[model samples]
Target: MTVFISPLIPVVIAVAALVIAVIKDYRIGTLIVVILAFTNVGGQQIFEAYHVFLLIIMLTAFSLTLAVLRGSVAVQGIKEFNILLAIFGTWSFLSGVIAIDHELWFGMIEYMIRAFLVLYLVYNSFSKGEEIFRLFKIIVFSMFLSSIISFFAMIGSLSLSVETLLSLFSTRFAGTIVDPNFYAMTIAGIIPLAFVLITEEKRIALKAFWIISVFFLMLTIVFSQSRTGIIAISIIFIYSLYNLMRKKRVEILFFIIPIIVILILIPPAFWFRMSVFVESLSSGARADTSVVHRLLLLRSALDVFLKNPIFGVGLGNFEAIAGRYTIDPMVCHNTYLEIASNLGLLGTVPFVLLLYRGFMLPKHSMQNPNVRELSWAVRTGLLGMYVAILFLSVPFKLDLWILLSIAAILGRKISSEKSP
Candidate 1:
């Protein structure tokens, strides 16, 4: 019952809203999307494996049936890239079918369930521009709230139940995330929303809260000392500000000035942690040395790739091959390498193309001012995600997988528009 306000509910509700809105008022359906965006990232889910997957299955079946009955096979905004990723994802899915290791194949296909949902959201997103704006507001508010908690947790202020469990032994800014880097990566994506919120949200109370969230979230990133999250934040900040400028949003100086001022007043300790990570990435080379241990992980993965290069070793079998290397098996931290290592050229190409086209479509759609606001906001957020994942990790979380599925739905829209 207490979980009713849980952050993750908004995302699924948004998906459901799209279905309902598609039948009647897309604007109403669009409200669900907004709620999910705001409530997107918080804590990990309690029930794992089957329960979550079952929900995804139900959503997919329902969405597909609704779309087909409507003759469009999608809500109003369904784009071509959505279908392409689904199709490409299927190839990846098929590779799982022929995968050498039983467990890994099952896991790879399991992950794609979220991909399907993202496509659903995107299909619905294209329904109306006002809804997109509304969703962006929700995304901003959620980020603001989460950032504040994370900041306090990092600085020795507000303590959360999740933090107590994760750092019961150690004091780090893992926050709502299971890993410090993952936490950092997720927050990094929030930077764009924060900037956008400060621009669009004129109410003084909202502005005060938004400003506070930014300061603290930045503080968490600093102490957690995640290089990727920090870097991604910088990139997103610059990119978003550029977008605002392009749109000529310079009139909001009264609001923007105070927020900018607050961001600059961060404690020096934050920079100290960041400096150390930079040192580690460059001449420090300690993290690299530790990464060297992954050589063993990579070699073992390569052995599997050699045997299954056409389809490769399959989606989830990276760990199975680890038996030849060491007793305790693990993930290859470099997701791109792991995918290539497991799935081979044959399996990896289609998936990459789907991402490539999905990312590109928003840029093509940005010429229209209304379309630009909605499309670029997501794209800018994605740009942060792209940057963060490269340094932090790949798409492993339920939230991330679900977001990808929404991207696919958007991809379908682009594909349809570009099609003959």
Candidate 2:
């Protein structure tokens, strides 16, 4: 006889684990949620119709409420970053209110709210340098896990051969994120964090783990075949090389060797794609259909922005109305352009301010010895992410928000240290 098990059993166990984690330590609970947010494992269809990730977040939030009531967690008031976030969120809501597709707008709005909550929780939960470092490690760990999963997915048959490798390079690796470009962008953002961990780690085993993680992550990006991801990786590599040479020259070998191997192993098709991408930038005649399509989308976004200079089409309305301007209906693949065309200057201004604040946090914290490495790591990671987003319409990415929160918390911690 076959025993029938209810699907709710797993859900109940997961809920219990999340509650226990939060009760023991709310920061740990936040980290668990961050891992889910980054890896997107909890969002998968593990429970059929139920949203396991949302349930975890709700339970964690409830546990946090209890912690606050017991005075274990202290709530802080609004600051500059919070003010900018609130303004941007409010403007987005207004834009959504007038959106052409209310359902799409509401969906995006809900995602934005969730991202903001993550930022708020992370910014408030951790205060110490060590705690912040753990947060970074957790993010790097998430990426490492994603890279491994992607590697296996790329090597479907687990057969090691030039033909198999070359065939795999022709295909993009989306991993758990389900979008090749976004997955590669996410990996690019985490690469610098992994590198920093390698440099700061005292134990040889941990350092080796980070170095291996970086290797897998680089491989994942290469398999993704995203030009934007490659560009971001180049920027990160140059920055990391310079820093390693200055601080830990010996560790440079660990960093450079993997890159050299990757370069040598990358198929000609990969190089050809890069060449085409570069040539297309200078001459539209040489551009592939994908490049031409993006160019058209860019023009459409500009046209929409011009028409609605103050508050463009409306949140999530660009996708609804894009077919009228372009041959195909799609969201503008450019984040800044998407924002400008969707919400106009009213929304873009505050959004840009929030990003500026995130960037400045690391700049201000550079002097603090306690968080100097972390500051550099966060800044470099953000630099890569910012460059990647120029070609991606991902305004509600939870990982980006979490990184910003880390920067904010580090900045505040540095400020507190400097104060008498």
- lDDT by candidate, in order shown: 0.56, 0.79
Alpha-carbon TM-score of each model against the true structure: 0.70, 0.90
Local error of candidate 1 at residue 149 (angstroms): 5.0
How much is the lDDT of residue 350 in candidate 1?
62
| Tens-digit per-residue lDDT, 1-420, candidate 1 | 364577878988986675565455433333443333334332334345345444534554465556568776445533544465655566677776666687767765655654455445445544344434455556556655665675555556536677664553245566645577777776666555565555556699977776666666666665565656767777876776665678687634533553475357534655655565566556665445434445556666666677667676667767667777767677665565567666687656765665566566566556554345446556666677777765432644444443444444333333323211
Kindly report which residue stretches of model 1 are placed more than 4 angstroms away from their true locations once superposed. 1-45, 48-79, 97-100, 146-170, 202-204, 238-290, 294-309, 323-328, 396-420
For residues 200-232, what per-residue lDDT tens digits would candidate 2 score against the true structure?
A: 888999988888888888887878888889888
Scored against the true structure, residue 343 in model 2 reaches a CA lDDT of 91
Best by TM-score: 2
